[model samples]
Target chain A: MSFIQTLKQSVGLSTDGLTKRKTVTFGDTTAVGNGRFWSIISVITLSMAWYLGSALELVNPIFWPAPSAVWDQFINISQDGYRNFTLWEHVWASLYRILVGFALGCLIGIPLGFAMGLSEIIRGWFDPIVEFFRPIPPLAFIPLVIIWSGIGERSKILLLFFAALWIMVIAARAGVGSVKLSKIHAAYSLGATKRQILMHVILPNSLPEIFTGMRVAMGICWGTVVAAELVAAESGIGFMIMAASKFLATDIVILGVIVVGVIGYAIDILMRKLEDKLIPWKGKA
Target chain B: MSDLVVNDVSMVFDTPSGEQVHALENVSFSLKQGELLSILGPSGCGKSTLLNIIAGFLAPTDGTVELASTEIHGPGSDRGMVFQQGALFEWLSVAENIGFGLTMKGTPKDEIKKTVDHLLETVGLHDFGEKAIYELSGGMQQRVALARCLANDPDVILMDEPLGALDALTREKMQGLVLKLWKETGKTIILITHSVEEALFLGERLFVMAPRPGRIKKEYSLPFAEAGVTKDPRDVKADPDFGAKREEILNMIWEMEEEIMGQAEE
Candidate 1:
């Protein structure tokens, strides 16, 4: 039988004489917890709150940037551009840097993390170096990155790679370490090779932690992209914010922050969805 | 029944402090291939050590164990070991755990599925092959562990108090299942236990060991297992030689323990 047939049979959908077919009836309360209506209602309520607060002058309209101010600023920036850069150009530049840095971090960090997790010798050598650099903020490295790589796109990406590497490596290492020795022993007792054990035992066990780290990295990278642009950039949202501030275009600054928030929130939500789809056996662990 | 001979096996564990503690001292015994034998002793006895040595997880300091013409050195597919705790892989489903040995041997996926299905039925977990290890009861998990071991169809099954962790009720139920499985498979089984009554009910011949510098002190040949099995073995306990053997073993263990303590103090 195929996988689906096997699954169906195990759940007692097989044509067995002793199978019990019980029907479950849902109550009205189930719909409330379904989340669809709740989400729409929350969004509407938040929008109304933003409008009312601006109308009432409860928050200073300049610093807070009322919805109308932010909307007008968005259209103006899209149409006329800022510092020889269109809004889309800035968004694309920042997004590209984030993706490249994240991919690079994962490439280098994950294997090193696994090595550190599995071998005490690796942990002993690398842990001190990790700790020494980890406390210094990624923004602090901005000066050296600019000097070494020049104030080009490369420096901005290197900043992000620096920001993300330690977090991913540590989370990955922790994830691998948390896997029980019994699981490894089980594979060994069954005569699985070392590579086989790492692929099946270590990788699967480390997945939940890896997903968690990715979510955090995405959030952190959103902030880092802006910081990366602050030092020197001909394009990007961070460059837009710094340039707008010189002209006292406060509305543009708030708009840039909100865009960052929205992007961060959307990416985090996607990360959660990926977690749900990948580790479908949550009820077991 | 292939005879298992332990030719002068002694297991002396050397500590980092340069002191040697004997876990098994020149222990020798032969087991009928399919006979269910239990080794009973006090807490510090070498009962489990003997099983571990036979499983090839540890080597005996001064002897060898042979299954017919084959000498056992390392854990192999021919000897299956069931630990006290059912060490089921958390991520693998019941069928996957059972099929693990086949997967390691590079057996085709389809053959693995068939063998896993057959073992699941044999272990009386016919419908649970897809369920997670955590979803099963303590008893059910042990059953899956057994099926996993049996998937390789080993000649001898070594159990180091496999039912020791269960509650009394589950333990009794598991005991019944073990006897049924033994009867069906006719596989040689070496059971290590601390419970005298459990030993009486499981072992055809009870081997008694002492704790200090642990060694096999006595071997009692008996037809107790079949008689003591069905919960009406009160009279079997009162058999002329049964009480005498138990008392003699108990006295020997006590003497050995004191001597060991004296040596340790010095």
Candidate 2:
């Protein structure tokens, strides 16, 4: 057996069992009867373990807040507000920044990527600058962005924008580049003009890759927005967390972190649903 | 005048190692209206290169291809080509794929639908019109490809090893379909194949090509394709004359392979 098969067998995973595990972990909606049940059970188990650990006082409450304490902090923030902004205001502010940054990245990156994929000259022009910025961590640019654009909302949004732009461009370029040559030949033989081939053949074929790029960009945008808020922000979930940390309100900090995680997960799920609806022929093609 | 004429076509490729590779040299042929011609050769014999040149996907280093006395410049609706595999757009439905050519010409939506439906029936894919390209089997996909090419009503249909990727049984079935379509439409067809049997079965006129500065080594006018239209392909193949011709062609190709092997060893 190969290493992967041997490892799976050693872990008591038969081929059928591995398939079932995949269905459960990846949320295969068609297999939801069993998968949904298992997913709920797993989540409940984790929450129980966390609650029990806190109740048993295994860690100091100052650093590791109990579930009830976090819940209380959540209720308190919702009712009394935090740092002059209500709970909804903090979430809305963060969402607004992410939307602006991600939308800008997509609008610019998709067209630029297509231009580069279609022409060697355009690729040469943009490739160097894109390559230079792609690998640099979004947080690393915070100092430069603040210096250049100031510590206003512009700097924070710009950080998030830069994070998403390169990923979208690379994905779109790869999508266009990988279209089969035979497909193009077939279209040409059928009397399709250059414009028609671009609109019909290239565009639909590249959509799945572009959608994947959008999802990745959204994730990156969320991370950069939070990190930007942590550095300097007047409102947002990141600001709430940073402010709570300063006052040693560990419960509030934990609540803020949980909220961020939950919101990010929700967004990811929504994107996946949209992908299924819009690009139903993705893997089938 | 012939329906299509290819005169003194030659193709040369400049290798990265500063060598000039002669892909095709002094190749010429003509096809009458409604005639079916097959080019048979081994790999590297430039049969495919010649087909590409005729399809207007490549410009020959010298010479020209003329249709009805008009010089061919590039790919156009006058000539349709069916590729071996991976030609169909996987995202489109079978009907949409067949109607693609019509859509490009701005055919009315209802006319496209009517024509696509007619093609779907012709290809025996009546129930598969709404199905995605990826859902069809290999033979079915090739059938769709043929129907797609036919939808444009081109004067000439170029098939480059269209059945090369199919299994033996499916290949046989597809051969019957090709012959049926050829008889029904009466369009000029130029098929390229490495299969000696396929070449004999499909071509009314055959060009046997050789490699190493690829050129036509011999030509044959065969009755198998005409007989196949009326009689069973198997019975046609089983004829004494067919058997003799098959043996002769097979021996010629075997000798060519041996010569290639000897050159490689030297």
Candidate 3:
């Protein structure tokens, strides 16, 4: 029997006389089909409509460039390049800043989070700083970061770092805080020392939360890098698109958007895959 | 010999509203080295608070818990605890969880393996040593918890409703396993449970507690736990004396619950 029907019957609702409707409800697990098929179909249909509309000049080419025009812009930039640097250079510049800033954030934020979660004193000292800055957008910091560091690579990377730092700290702290009191007590009663309990019980337990935080931090870093580059930076995808927008190079702008979106999506997918492999017991417990 | 002693233990919680809640009041008991004691009480009766005090997880406001004549200042390996659920490390396999205490103490790998294997067999989970905690059924998880607690070879084993989450059949079988392990290992056990029949069947000595300044209201020494070792628990529970005792304790707890409810309404 279907789960909903069984539930209804158990709750004393008459399933005997009523006609069974083969329809999906919001919470019906059995009704949840593989959504991937629909996702692919929607993408295909949208692309066809876009291509057909562009080919027939349904709208001005300046405002909504065709996919083919974007493709051509991609090839044009790949060869002759956007500005003096090649296409890869712009992509590489953005990626390098994100990786370096994100790496620095994780390096500092994770330990800081651990400290905060483990000690009341540390939490009290740092809580104000984190909580104060957490809600403010990375874009808000761009102006201050530029003023402090100037419109250089340091400014862009620093903005990305700040964007990621708060998220990683919160994630790591939550991971440590989420450890069950029972698990800790059990470990202690099992004769584990404080250090051993931290290493074995608390660390492993917090990994799922940490992974989730990393994913969120990476995504925010991607967005912050672009915004930072948009505001400043001489070379990056954001710079490329901003430079193109000046001359109404809509095709190049579209190309840049697609590339950034694809990479952002790919990074999230990769993080999810890594999370699955490393922490198979993520939500089970 | 009295291996464990609770000396005038009382736990008073101060609410944020500046109200003092007497969770436990002047509770005291002592157990022989291999005795099985089950504590039965309604909700908010400080049964768990008392157990936590004994386990050294909580410091009672005005008492001391000593095991083997030494005061328990904090949680140590000499005392093991099995919780009802979610106490096992989800990241670790069944064997890893069972051998966790030994590993923490830096025991040799071969010895940990040997002990873990033996415990797997003891708990009837011999083939499930490599399985993750989430993959196991609720009953199997509790078995893992039991084995994990036993692996420590502690002087006392404290269980807080260890089989509470299991279905009826699983709970019955686990109760039998508890009796068997208690008999074979000869370790002192103090189990807190809500089920009256469970208390009667598994506890050689049963303590029924009252709420609102939780204290031991009555104690009964039963033959059912020993009798349950060799014979079927069902048959032992069917005895007239067992039924009579179960009824009396049930009535006592029911009255206490009623009084607490009536007070709450007032």
| Best candidate according to lDDT | 3
Candidate 3 lDDT over residue span A1-285, tens digit each: 689877655544543332347454568665554555557678899999999999999999999999999999889899889888778899999999999999999999999999999999999999999999999998999889989999889988888889889999999999999999999999999999899988999999999999999999999999988878887889999999889999999999999999999999999999999999999998888
Candidate 1 wrongly placed segments (more than 4 Å): A1-53, A58-60, A74-92, A234-237, A280-285, B1-3, B14-20, B40-48, B193-197, B207-209, B217-224, B227-266
Per-residue lDDT of A148-238 in model 1, one digit per residue for the tens? 9998889988988988898889889988987865466555556667898898778987888887888888788878888778668878888
Compose the digit string of candidate 1's lDDT tens values, residues B1-266.
Answer: 46788889988887899988788888888877788888887766788788877877788879999987678887666777676663676667889989887888899999999999888888889999889887888888889878887887778888778888788888777777787788778888888876665776678878888776787777877676666555445577678777776677677667776876896799
Residue ranges of candidate 3 with Cα displaced over 4 Å: A1-29, A35-37
Residue range B162-264, candidate 3, lDDT tens digits: 9899999999999999998998899999999989999999899999998889999899999999999999888999999999998899899889888988998
RMSD of each: 8.6, 5.6, 5.3
For model 3, the TM-score of its B chain against the native B chain is: 0.98
Q: Please give, for every candidate in the order listed, the TM-score of chain B alone compared with the true chain B.
A: 0.87, 0.97, 0.98
Misplaced by over 4 Å in model 2 are: A1-45
